[model samples]
Target: MTVQLPPLPEIHHPKIQALFQKSDRELVTLFQRHPEEGQYFAAIFCRYGQVLYTLISTATRSPVQSDYLFVKTWEYIYHEMRVLDLRVTTPRLSLQSWLINIAAMMINRAEVPPVEEIQYSLKDTPPVFWCYLNQALNQMAGNLRLVLLLSQTFQWSHTRIAAYLHAEGESISASDVKQLLVRAYQALEDALPEDIRDIYLAQPAVTA
Candidate 1:
């Protein structure tokens, strides 16, 4: 004989809908001011939870790893939110990018089984383009490279990056990261072919 399971509790859909109406920045502020009201935090999670999960899953390609990273990322976000200074930390990308950045660091630390390498070269151009890009990235200064990688690869905000670098004994600030990122992009653009440079120029401005 099979035992009957109890039905799941109904979620307050109206409350969730109301939460969705508020912007991420607004929700964050509300949560910060009223930490006891968990709905505000729940609302923020509802907005970006699925997107973050998808990103983690795609990167890790393992259900167990993805689930672990997903939980860890949210934990970091919650802790950071408590100490976050809204004046300095602008949610330029509406907090989604910031969340993804945290997830990326977790992804980087997780050990994954190695996969076979496959190289594919487009027939449209010479292979030197790829080489040039790699060379440009390699030749960048250590600090410049760190800022570029953290900003471009991880989508970390300038203020977050500044704190990370400062903790490592680097004398830097958000303004410095912004300037260094601009210079790094310029150098990379100059190193690329004109056509590729134009494509890069057409892309949207990088949110700090």
Candidate 2:
């Protein structure tokens, strides 16, 4: 016969529960102050886990790769938090943006397979609309196109887009990324007809 084991104690506490209500910055600060608490990090994970998962899924486009990147991104964040000063490294940085930056780096390093292009028949949608859309995309500058793809297609944050561009030896700032996105959208709106533009505008915004 085996002896019975004692039940584990509950980990809940009023102070720890309060961390869930704190802002990202506030939670990070508390975590920095009390590295051993673990609750602060748990709070952060609960807040941003889905956002980062979406970003990773979009970037990898493979369930297995997305799962790996999701875990790796958080591992990188935890390592950085333990080794660096969060106040110095992420001063005034939105937690979502910071997490996206880490995810973007991991995605860049991974070798993701190319997505197969879906060939749509002209009858599927208005051929005129497709033509106008192509023209609009073509009119965008190469850098602007890249920024749009990163922001709209991959659901990257402006900060992540800027950082990725900078890593690729392009001198870009987050403000520049925002401006580029605005210019791209304006160009698309200008190229499309009024009806098509309205249709496009009614589409849901992409988020990461």
Candidate 3:
């Protein structure tokens, strides 16, 4: 949680620390308005680095791929910051949503490994994919959603998931974990919007 970006502790110097104190909108303005001052952009990066990393890592499920996309996402942000007009964006996303959409876009665009090795690799998708995915997930049952997220995002084994639930006093057996996962997949498919389903159908099937 601490800002440890090298050579520029965003919270170290009084002036730099002040950048951290500003709101996202404020930080964004400084980032755009004063492209020469990296402190503003650095502050935003330091603030959201963990969040972005978590999002990328969960989606990719491969440490190596996650690392690559994490850096690339920021690189994209750095290059596109000037032209990003949050106010005028369709559907009008806040800064955080915009950042997430960028990550989702990048993840979708990333090349898939050979089909044999592609377990959780996602296909190229429209930005609306991320937007609607949140809504679909919200519609799923609590237990189903939790199991699905843990399996897909964390790549947790069924036994690991059972142990996790057991420790939490839920006593979910591994067999139950398997069943829950099946239902979870069905639930997710049923919950997704029609457009998203169409998008998935349009893509070549990924054998996972």
Give the distance in Å from residue 108's predicted Cα in candidate 3 to where it truly belongs: 0.7
Residue pairs with backbone atoms closer than 3 Å in model 2 (clashes): none
Predicted structure 2: lDDT? 0.62
Model 1 score (lDDT): 0.62
* TM-score, every prediction: 0.44, 0.42, 0.48
Give the number of the best model, judged by TM-score.
Answer: 3
In model 3, what are the clashing residue pairs, if there are any?
none
Best by lDDT: 3
Q: Per-residue CA lDDT of candidate 1, range 1-208, in tens?
A: 2222122111233444677778777888887897534456556665666667677777776455455556556666776876665456555544777777777887887554433322222222212233335556877777777888899667899999999999999899899989999998887766654533332233555898
Encode model 2's per-residue lDDT on 57-161: one tens digit a residue: 776655554555565566668657654444556355666777788888888885543334323332233222344465467777788778887886688999999
Each model's lDDT comes to 0.62, 0.62, 0.68
Clashes of 3: 0
Worst 10 residues of 3 by lDDT: 1-10
- 119 in model 3: Cα distance from truth in Å? 24
Question: Model 3: per-residue lDDT, tens digit, 1-208?
Answer: 3322223223354455666658988888877787434556656776776677777777775555665566667767776876788889999999889988888898889663543453332223322234345557888999999999889878999999999999988977999999999999888777764534544333555898
